[model samples]
Target: MTNASTGQMTPATSGVLLVLAHPALERSRANRALAKAAKGLSGVTFKDLYEIYPDFVIDIESEQAALSAHDVVALQFPLYWYSTPALMKEWLDLVWLHGFAYGEGGEALKGKKLFVACTTGAGAKAYHAHGYNRFSMDEFLRPLEQTAHLCGMVWEAPFVVHGAAVKDDAALKAEAERYRARVASLLPAKTEA
Candidate 1:
């Protein structure tokens, strides 16, 4: 795929694991559009956490294996209650183990890239100190950044679709395209041997 911003053809080497965490995907237009945007990209692996682990039973080994195979890990979700959905939290707790994600021997995720692509119900103006939400989106995402730090991963800027609930169809489509481009950009260039 060609990157929209740089106009460069992204090689297949740019492996991205997009972990989606929307609890009720059927009910969300924004997330569904975003997910559709990511579908069938060359080196992008899409995993819906809620669908894969409906009972909250995460396969630690599988999750770890998936992480190990990707250069970029993107968490896609809706900002629920100012944080990730409960299943995402649970997945992190179970998969990011002491010896795998952090601690003495946890070097598996070192140098990997971590990012979040999320939707927010509130508008951009509502996410400031003076706004009703009372905090910037960046502020609300600090914990995820810190998690990347602790795991020795590179924290990339998050892709946020603000005011999702009220965006018109055109706006939603544009946002989804932007998201697809962002995900495509995360892929590293292919080096010739």
Candidate 2:
């Protein structure tokens, strides 16, 4: 995508890798809708973590290769107990190793971008200081932000779909469209090869 201020196309050689992690994909309406929306976009790769590794054994080398091939990494999941699903956490711990993702000689992800898209059961109003959940989504996602920092990736503002459980069909579809647009917007403009 071209930057609005500079009118320069973003230098994205590889494209985006959208990693989806939902323990129960069939049971999650919001996550299903969101994933469906992002399925066929150009320059985007959609991967389902649970589907790939049901045994909870992640392929670190493969995961790192995928990351290396993508200019942007998008994590899509349903918020569970204010954190990510167990498999997603496992993927992070296993794939983002010290020598590869952080510590000395860990410059593999230095210029990559990290984006997060999450669905929450509670409404937006419930994620505030005076609200029921008692913390904003950004606050809940601090760990992820820090992870990006440590990996030397640029942390993008997250895209959140709140009140997912109660949203009507129309609202859910609208949210899905919004998600599609957001993901598409991250793509870099076409350049001559």
Candidate 3:
């Protein structure tokens, strides 16, 4: 892939796949910025679920192939009702089949890594036991962690942005950079050869 700003070519095979899920991306400032940052990075393959499957009809073989081609899979989205967007859930249900993800001959994701990068409208304090949400982010994210465990994949600590709807421009930009850096860190290191 080519670096948008540097005007230079980067490695096309980064072994990193970032799947983004947002029902209405244009309406989201934080998600849009993060998506741009992720797409600009080198050594990463970015796929927008909503954009690709607007009709909610996913191509199973293509999705599976993309997953099989990458070592690290990053799921990016805005937290909706304390869970992923509807399309993301659908994608999970359809693409992550029993035989392909967690049964006999379902070792495609084994030993790989799964990471979540999400933005929440509420502040971090809202996710506490005594807070409005009455649960921690980790608690809300348990399902995904368990999914990784079930698939024999390593679960990395998530990258979260609280108060997604209210961040100032500077804060938003910083979050985007932070996200890009975090995703880039997951890319396989280049060899000296």
Candidate 4:
């Protein structure tokens, strides 16, 4: 796989870690489908935050271990109030610690890849300068991009399913398939021994 920003080839053994953060995943058609699609792919470790941490008490050591094990970290979530869910924020605050993810001696995430996949209730048109949201998706995702940079992680182009709430069954399925393919493409190609 080639890095999206650098146009450089990635290691053949790089694995992927997909973290899904949806508080009400059962009610979200888009997130559920995407999670199902991603969970079946090879070289991907999928985790459902809400399912594992219903109490919002995250295991910092386990989360850090998962991050260290994978070369690519994909965050899958819905646009909750134009940002990640409260639990995800809490996890980041706790897991991404000063000496682990940043600051002095915090080189664990360096050279890793960060990918963001999100679903928005409003359509693409609604997230423009003159649209209802008055900001583009890129604008809203700046913080994540910056976070990736701060941790020395390469930022990949985000995958978004706009107007997710209104997409019909077929459209939603297609989006999920596309997301699966996109995530798969990020995985390193296996080599025969």
Report clash pairs, candidate 3. Answer: none
Cα-based lDDT at residue 178, candidate 4: 98
Alpha-carbon local distance difference test for all models? 0.91, 0.91, 0.91, 0.91
lDDT per residue for candidate 2 within 1-193, as digits (tens), equals 5667888985545778999999999999989999999878989988999999999999899899888878889999999999899999999999999989999988778889999999998899999999999999999999999999999999999999998999999999999999999989887666664
Model 2 TM-score relative to the real fold = 0.92
TM-score of each: 0.91, 0.92, 0.92, 0.92
Off by over 4 Å in 2: 1-13
Question: CA shift at 15, candidate 2, in angstroms?
Answer: 1.0
Ten-residue region with minimum lDDT total, candidate 1: 5-14
lDDT of 1: 0.91
State the lDDT at 14 in candidate 1: 52
Candidate 1 similarity to native, TM-score? 0.91
lDDT of 3 by residue, 99-184 (tens): 89998989888888999999999999999999999999999999999999999999999999999999999999999999889988
The window of 10 residues in a row where model 2 has the poorest summed lDDT is 184-193
What residue runs in model 4 are displaced by over 4 Å at the alpha carbon? 1-13
Give the least accurate 10-residue stretch of model 4, judged by summed lDDT: 5-14
